[model samples]
Target: MAETPAADVHPPYLYPDYKSTRLRAPAQPLVRVAPSPLDTAGPTFPKHFVKDSEADLTTWGKSAPLGEKMVLVGRVLDEDGRPVRRSLVEVWQANASGKYPHPVDDHEAPLDPNFLGKGQVLTDDKGRYRIVTVKPGAYPWQNHAFGWRPAHIHFSLFGNAYAQRLITQMFFPGDPLLAIDPIFQSVPEAGRRLLIADLDLEHGVEGVALGYRFDMVLRGPRATPMGV
Candidate 1:
């Protein structure tokens, strides 16, 4: 009996326009614990812990890494839409001028000595999953005076252990900074179009790259809005 999240779908741990969720949300009132046995069975994930060039974040350093080159397929359903096969996704972004090779990200753009954005994959038997990065720019956060942060891409999804993880962020479809992105408006405009991401010209790749399609849905009423 665990499937009742279709009101706002999800998002509101205390979203006061996402000012760090007002100091990291959760101000008392959430204490349920009862899952052990290693959280329902061990942490399986072998088959060489992902490596096939690590799902291609544009060849991971040493060349090819500038901007505007996409291709992010999807799929990992389960809410009866089936298909949640291998699992384990993971991603990360911000590079193409929005910076973030991390050190705390000073911003001020410019940082792509081959773009070490991030990547990882695994999910076949039909649950799909593809990547190949580039296209991330849009950053400037203080969360108030001209705050910006749209072009996202930060999913995480893992299952069959580690307490069945899940995280989200995928935006990028017309992105006018997603109308003043307060963490994507704290996601509730009807699940905010399920975190946008749908261009898919057959999943592009004729002149090099251009697909989008971001499907996730791990829960009820079409869930897919958990960017934390």
Candidate 2:
């Protein structure tokens, strides 16, 4: 994991405390990602990056206080390697405590009335999407006291034409929880590697400009499977 400077304890935007362990950055370059292997068709992904990217509801942020600036950037594609134009990508994170910003969360974390902990964006023809949101903090659960969630962002994406939606979470390179989190450990080791994202140390994104590439392939109809 690359080393990231410590962000102040922002009330609404909670980030986990990194113990400063050196983790190696991902080996693959920040290139577009491939679609889920389940999509045997190997068709081109849609291309509508930024074409229809917008928040269906700004209230998702809930007017919680904001830092000087914040944004999340990533790409989405399909089985055929085409961009899923205007595909809606929804995300929700805890209010700094790994607890959701919703009032129903029994956890005692403070909720940023304006920070709804949710946001949306659309993928471009290039199969990419970007969102401006505060960094989420890691919080504890009955699972573990030091059980902080690896600093991460949740991503929910709708595949072509709203047929089916894929929901997954993106984790920072070195939050220290990926090794112990049961949820993170659930996926097969081969697929588990997909969720790990690369840090944008050079893109010069204003705040935490994290980069991720997730291409969804909703297995549909009989299709020839690719021989791996």
TM-score of each model, in listed order: 0.33, 0.61
List model 1 lDDT by residue over 34-69, tens digit each. 655555443567878988788888886788999989
lDDT for each residue of candidate 2 in 1-228, tens digit (9 for 90 to 100): 222221111111111233221133343333433445444323233454323324422334435454323445666655555555656677777655455756566666676666666666666666676665555677765544556566567787665532345678877666677887756665556666667766564533645343333334432222433331
- In candidate 1, what residue range of length 10 has the lowest lDDT sum? 219-228
Residue 37 miss distance in model 2 (angstroms): 21
* Candidate 2 lDDT (Cα, 0 to 1): 0.53
Instruction: State which candidate has the highest lDDT.
Output: 1
- What would the TM-score be for candidate 2 when compared with the true structure? 0.61
lDDT of all predictions, in order shown?
0.77, 0.53
Clashes of each: 0, 29
